[model samples]
Structures are given as structure tokens and as C-alpha cells.
Target: MFINNTWYVAAWDREVGADGLFSRTIIGVPVLMYRDSEGRLVALEDRCCHRGAPLSVGRREGDCVRCMYHGLKFDPSGACVEAPAQGRIPPQARVRTFPVMERHRWIWIWMGDPERADPGLIPDTQWLDHPDWRSQDGYIHYDVNYLLIADNLLDFSHLPFVHPSTLGGSEDYASISPKVDRLPDGVRITRWTLNTEAPAFAKKVREWAGPVDRWNIYNFTLPGILLMDSGMAPAGAGAQDGKRDGAIEFRGCQALTPETATSTHYFFAHPHNFSIDQPEVTASIHQSVVAAFDEDRDIITAQQRSLSLAPDFKMVPLSIDAALSQFRWVVARRVEQEQQQAAASATGARPAQTAA
Candidate 1:
């Protein structure tokens, strides 16, 4: 159920260090990543073309990686350049290389055709490294499908029940329905809760005299990327009207990469524009967000277990399911379109070979 042609978050920039080889299973394919001698990022199929040994366990020789199993060395392009024991390297002795790029403190990899990997299509997440905003990188691994996490993100009504003490503040979040708008690649959801008590985490970061007005506006894009602008201000501060005076602003960035059929790699960070100079404030916010996510993970994993037991059971829809349903449709359509295109290409290639 994965979109093969889409770009996915391979890893945080810090995960693959200058001299370290990192490997992870993305969409069930093992990927080996590292920086070349010139410091350029490289992503290649982890399996060595010879004997099927993983290249991650091999040794790095300057800009190239050498498979220690049979003494075959490959360049950054995944082309076999040397075979120590053979007179010549076969033309087909090469591993597949994926299109990879580094931006916004994350490494992005295109899992399909290299020719279709356009850097411009990558989403903008400047808050991740912008000077005005401050945040720390956070990553979590889940033993559940990535789409399940996406479902959790699209609907906020569960916050009051799932994240009661942390992200959830009051029942108003569950009672008040949000506005869901369709986007070209995904969906946009906006919700406002007025004159409500701040969540426990918010109170730890800033002092609130009484009730406040808060807004959560975010865009969940294809391949599971969420960039959000959520914040709070005093009850009469006019935040809902677009005035930011005396407002505590935060930017939420989250990326979900499918590890396998029932597992996911979650990368996230919530940056705050207000406390740019205070590292403590950033740490507190990060800790709270992690705690809240732990709560989400506990319930989502339990639900996944139950789903496995009842594979034929269908979930009933509710008003809160609007955004998630739309987002799932967008995903399904893209995946179907990709499958159709692949089938067409295969059909066209067969005819060209027959004519030749």
C-alpha cells in the first residue's frame, strides 16, 4: 500500500554522520546511506549484487563502498568498479541507486524512477533550520502501519481522550468540529478552541493568567508530511482574527516513513518562535511532545493488534473521520495512478522489444 514514486523521509541529517554507514528498511527495501569522500550524500540498495550480502556491513573505501564478502567495490553510483579476484568486472555487477537529496535537516529519497525525482516537488519546511525558530530533532519507531499514524494525525478529536494530560486541554477540542479543506496533494485542517484552559504542557512553557484562545492549522501532505502552525493567546487577544500580539507561537513538523507492512519510522520536531534564546523551554516542549506521542503510540499499537485479529471488520465512520478519510483517498488515488503507469510502461516496452 505504499506509493512507490513518492519521496519519503529516509533519515534525519544527523543519523548518517560523515564516517558512519546507516541502514534501514524503507517500504521493505533495505537502504544503505552514507556521505561520500566529498561529503555528498549517497543512497544505494543495501544488498550487494554478488551473493546478496548487505553492503552496510562492508567497508568504506574513500568515496566508494567495498563489499567484503567477495571483494567487490562499488562507487557512489552503485556501479561495480573493482573485483579483486576476477580479471574483469561484469557489466551487470552493480547495485541500484536511489535519488537522494538533503534539505531542511532531513534526507529525502525517491523510491521510484530516478528520472522523475524532481527536487522542486519537495515540500518546504524552512522552520526546521530557520534562524528565528528553535527546536531539537526527535525520532520514534512504531510497530504499526504508517497510515494508522496518519489517521491519528488528521483527526484531533481523539486528543481529549488519548492525550488528556499533555496535548489535550478540555472537552471543547472533541466537541468542536474542525474545518477540513482539500489540497492538491493532501488536506488542510483548521480548528479553533476559544476561552479554554491551556494544555498542561503549554502551561509549563509560559504563564497563563486564565483561559485562552487557541488555533490549530496544519497541512498534511502526501507520503505523510505534516507542517503545522498552532498557538495560543489570551482570551481576548484576537488570535483567531489573525492578530499575533502577545501570542505564543509554535511550528510542528512531522514525517512518517513506512518501515514495513505493520511498522513505521516517525521523525518529528515542534519548534517554538517565542523562546528562541531559551534552550530549557525547547527541551520542556520537546519532552512534553514526546510524552504525548507515547500516549498515542500505546493506544495505536493496541488498536493495531485488535485489527490484526479482526481483519475483516470494518471501521464505522464519524464526523471526526472527515479529514482522515479524504487523506486516505488521496493516498489511494496516487498509488493506483502509479500502478497504472507502471503497467502501461511494461506493456509499451514489450511491444518495442517485439518490433526490434
Candidate 2:
């Protein structure tokens, strides 16, 4: 579940164009996002107050979005600016507006109380701005609870078996042990082994970039944002010679927004060295990664279904799953805290539980 009072990835930068309207769900709340004439971002409840028509179906007019059912127009702040039929705005006719911001090639939306909206609350990513790194962007839809994806990402032990043909089937998997440090902002930074049997790509890195020692790092920010290192060695340098040494590096960010208790929308950003200077090479890398993602989608969806069908499913986890277990507890605690806060607000009482 997404933490309350946090910014979640709503859409890619290029997805929202002039006069474009996109509707998405965050934490089970439907939101409508659009761009104004001046290229400013705005978000509001997808539901129109009038007869419950979806405002996302409305047409864009200047800085306002007009309801298709009636000609009612709403400003960026969701204030009812014009009512074509009444000629005067009704006091209670306004729709709720949400605070939004654009950063790091993504549009972020506030899903909790509007008063808690703070641009600084958004996760920080200094790596994205580094000139030495290149980035690619994409999205994925998961047919499982978002929390599971978060767990999967926090642990890399599954890589050896789940992604054998991809980046995992290497000598590094044998001695894999993650070093995790929790940050003051509730984020976790983890660095783990990355080369086992040193894959073809690692070999390439040794050849072109000199002696290679592979390690993967992940910075997981609260409410489902992960920044991971995606650089790998080239072929023939770390492993046997002339063995199709091309490897794809995947440093990127992922945001898992809950569509419901059972589904999630995954926004991913992958940056690699091979495609840093070439647009064509970048596009090819994106396609290849997308195919791998499709493989993951199939596996995760099946796991979700099977888990849902089980009555008392339980699996004993090894040390490698520690990060995953810790992440799950963090998510569970955050969700519980939000629920307690909401209950307390309803009764005007002190919160029953506080953050640890």
C-alpha cells in the first residue's frame, strides 16, 4: 500500500501533452490529471460533482477543464469557474483539487489530505541529474498487490532462479549478501553482489572498463520508489572469450501505485551505459528490458493467483529474504498508521499508534 501524505508517480512526462486528459488511480482513489495552456500540471477528482459523471471525459478549455455531461468548467484548483446553463456558479459545486508537481520526468500527485501536500516531501534522486548517467522510462501493470512487487525488488536472491537468462545467472549469486542501511527519511539503501560465474556482460566490462567487480545498489524511498544501479560489464572480459558478451545495465526508478488491493500500476525508469549517447541504442535496450518485464509480469501474476487461492500459505524464508520481510513490515506499519490516523481524526482523539 502507498503511504499517506506521500507523492506517487502518476504518469510519464511525455504522456501528458497539451489538451490531454489522463485518468489514473492512486491508493484506490481515482484522479484526473491534465496540463494547462501554459504547460502547468493540475490534478483533481476524476468524478464530476454533477450526476457523478467522470470529469476526465470532459474537454479541455484554456486553463480549465469542462465537463462533457454539462458545460460546467473547473479551474486548475478545481473551483467551479463557469456554469453554462446556470450562468452563475453554485457555492457547493466545486470539485476537490489535488496538489501536483513535475520532477525527474515524472508527474507526481498528492493522494492524502491536501494540507499535507509539500513538494519537498517527494523523494530525492541526485543520480538522475548526474551527467555521467543516461536514463530510459517505461511503465508496467501488475496483476498482484503492489506490496509483493516492493518485496520482490527489495530482495535479489530470487534473481539467480527467476532471471537466470537475464542478469542473475552469474558467479556473484553464490556469495550474495546485501548490506542494508536505513536512512533518516525512512528510506533504505542496499548494496549486493552482482556477478556470479561472471556473466558475459561482466566480461565485457572487464575488457573495456578494466578489471571489474560487480555490485548492485538500490535506494528504496518510502511509498514505492526505488532507485537501482543498472550497470554491468561487457562480454568476454569477466567470462569466457567470444561468448556473446553484450549485457544490459538497468539503473532506474520504479513506482508502484495501488490500483486496488489486488492490482498495481508500476512506473519504471531504466538507464544504461550502452544507450547513453545513442537514441536508437536506448530504444533497443528499452525493448529488450520490456520483454524481460513481460516475463516477470507473467510469473508474478501467477504467484498472486495461487496465493489468493491458498487457505494458509506460508513459506520459510532464508537470510536472503530478510530485506523483503523488512520491507513488508514497513509497508504494513505505514498502512496501519494511516488507518489509525484516519480513525483518530474521525473521533477527534489522539492517534492510537505512532511511527517507530
Candidate 3:
């Protein structure tokens, strides 16, 4: 399981309304999120202390969340500010509040110890600031473990068989070799080439002119975020050189937060450079990609069910799975390191021995 100690994309900042409540599950934990009257975002454990009802089901009252069950009000800090029934605050009455921040139009939540929540820990995205890139937001729910989806994203080999209609045409099932590189600050980059004719989507872009060569950069930051650079260059040009020409590039970032062991909340943003600044052109590109993603949703969800039923099932992987293996190992190592740090903290908190 992915550790809860890392940062996960919660929601788009614009999606959270000042007077509305939103409920979402992150890493299998139900959480209630909202913005205060000042437009500051806040997150708290969803359960109401009064009767265990979800706080999100309640209404907002003067910057506090008022429970519908008994009119109990909780402040942004999770304090029971008003309990009409009791008329006084109980010593033990409080909901767990989490650290949240808004960045690049997205709301991010820190699920681990609040003391360790550092906004700087979130991966830096300088490219988004570039004037040339145009950004689009998308969301989807997947009935599968977040890991399965992560693995799928890291492996391009499945494109031919699983996503032939969408982004799979370049998949040459026979000769795919993936390479992985570890970078500083818990960053990993996976690279691979899919050798096949361009898919319909790529062909559409090709109609503008030039042959097609696809080069992919699969970047995995700590926790559950994935940044993908899917670029198509003129055919016959080397992979590196293809990027220099007027190629159609799709840069997508995905945040997969586990709703349960078998369900996940998938949030994605695609910011591109080609014809994206224009609303009409951007809408056309967004629609095309969304159609492809809908196709993948069916394939990934079924794959998850199949894997769950047969725990021992293992298939021979092609060379393309090398990067995936690297990714899995990196995640495992990070989780292990976090566990060790937590254990060490616990040991240091023990009471000291009295003088003998």
C-alpha cells in the first residue's frame, strides 16, 4: 500500500465552493473538505463526533460546518465550536483536521503527521508557469487499486492489446525496452519507445504534416502522482531530435488517491503547448483525449477484478516492464523508509529511566 506520509492531490481549488461541502476518501480514509468564509481551504475527518454522520452532509454556517444530525458546529481547525444540545464544549469532542494548501488551481492535503507537512515537499511544476502551455483539468473514478493504475501508467507494453483504439497504435509488442533513472528528492523517470504506426489520434495531428515518432517520459514523484510526457515527432528522426520539431505533445499529471483497497479517485490535468492557448483547439484536444481515457477505464477496471480473483496469477512481461519494476521498487523503498522513521520517533518518545 502507498504510505499516507506523502502529499496527494486532493481536488482542484475552483471545485471547492465557499458555502459548499465536499467529501472524498484519501488513502482509504473518508475526509470532509471545504473552504471557510475567507476562502481558505480546510480538511477534516468526515465523521461527525455527535452521531458519526459525515460532516460533509451538513451545511456551512459562518465559516463552520454545522452537523445536520444535531446542529453541532465544527471550526476549520476541527474544534467543536458550537454544540447546541450540550451548550458547552466537551473536553474530548473534536474532529481530526489535516493540513491543506492550494497550488496551481489544485488543493493538496497532507495525510501524515501535520508537523511533517511541508508545502515545499510537493513536487515543483515550473513548466506550468510557462506562457506557452495551456492547462486542462479532468477527473475520473476507477474501480481498482491505485497501484494497478500506477503500474499500467508506467508500462507502455499494454498499449497494443489494451488500448489499440486510443493511444496504442505505436505499441510494438515485440521490441519494447524501458529505462529508469532515479533523481533527487524522491523523483524517478522512466523512458520507453513504442514502435508501430501512429494511432488515429496521432494521425490526426500528423495530417497537419510530417512523419511520427513517439517518445515518452514517465515521471513518478513520491506518493501517488504521475507526470507523463507523451510526444510525437516526425518519423525517421531520432527520438531526441523529434522533440525539437513542431510535434504534438501531451503533458499530463495524474493524482491517484486510494478510496479503498480496490477503488481510487483519479484526478488528472493535461497542459499542452500545441494549439492549446485557443479555447476551441484546446476543447478539441481535450475531447479527443477524454474519449481515449474512457476506453482505458473499462480495460483497467476489468484487469483489477481479474487480478484480485487470482492472487497468484503472474504473466511473462516484455522488456517494457523494466521501468515498471524500477518504479515498484522505488515506491517500496520509500514506504519502508517512512516506516522506519515513524518507529524511531516512537522509540524516542518513551519515558526515561529514573535514577537508580
Quick one: best TM-score, which candidate?
A: 1
Residue-level lDDT tens digits of model 2 in 1-356: 46767788888878888767989887788899888878888889988887778888888888888899877888888888888768667889988888888887778888888888989888765445456656577799887898778777777666666666554555456456777766543446455342335543333333444333355677776778887764544423442222325554556777888888888999875666554677766665556557667767887888898999995999788877666666776776777888889889999999885657
TM-score of 2: 0.85
Q: What is the C-alpha lDDT of each candidate?
A: 0.92, 0.72, 0.74
lDDT of 3 by residue, 1-356 (tens): 66777788888776788768999888877899887777888899999987898988898887888889888888888999888857678967889989998777668899888988988888655444457887667888888888778877776667777667766674463255656766532345544453347666666544635445667776776676777787766666566654446667777777778788888888876777877546766666666667777777888888887888999998777665666666666777767767776776788753433221
Residue 47 displacement in candidate 3 (angstroms): 1.0
Q: When superposed on Cα atoms, how far off is each prediction in RMSD? A: 3.7, 4.6, 4.6
Rank all candidate structures by their lDDT, best first, as comma-separated numbers. Answer: 1, 3, 2
lDDT of 1 by residue, 1-356 (tens): 79988889999999999996899999999999999878899999999999999999999989899988988999999999999878988999999999999999989999998999999988888989999999999999999999999999999889989988999999887888999999988999999999998999999999999999989999999999999999999998899999989889999999999999999999999989987899999999999999999999999999999999999989999988999999999988888777777777888743222110
Residue 288 lDDT (model 1) = 92
Full-model lDDT, candidate 2: 0.72
What TM-scores do the predictions have?
0.97, 0.85, 0.88
- Model 2 residue 82 CA deviation (Å) reads 3.0
Ranking by TM-score: 1, 3, 2
Evaluate residue 165 in candidate 2 and report its C-alpha lDDT on the 0 to 100 scale.
59
Error of 3 at 268 (Å): 1.4
Task: Give the total clashing residue pairs for model 3.
Answer: 2
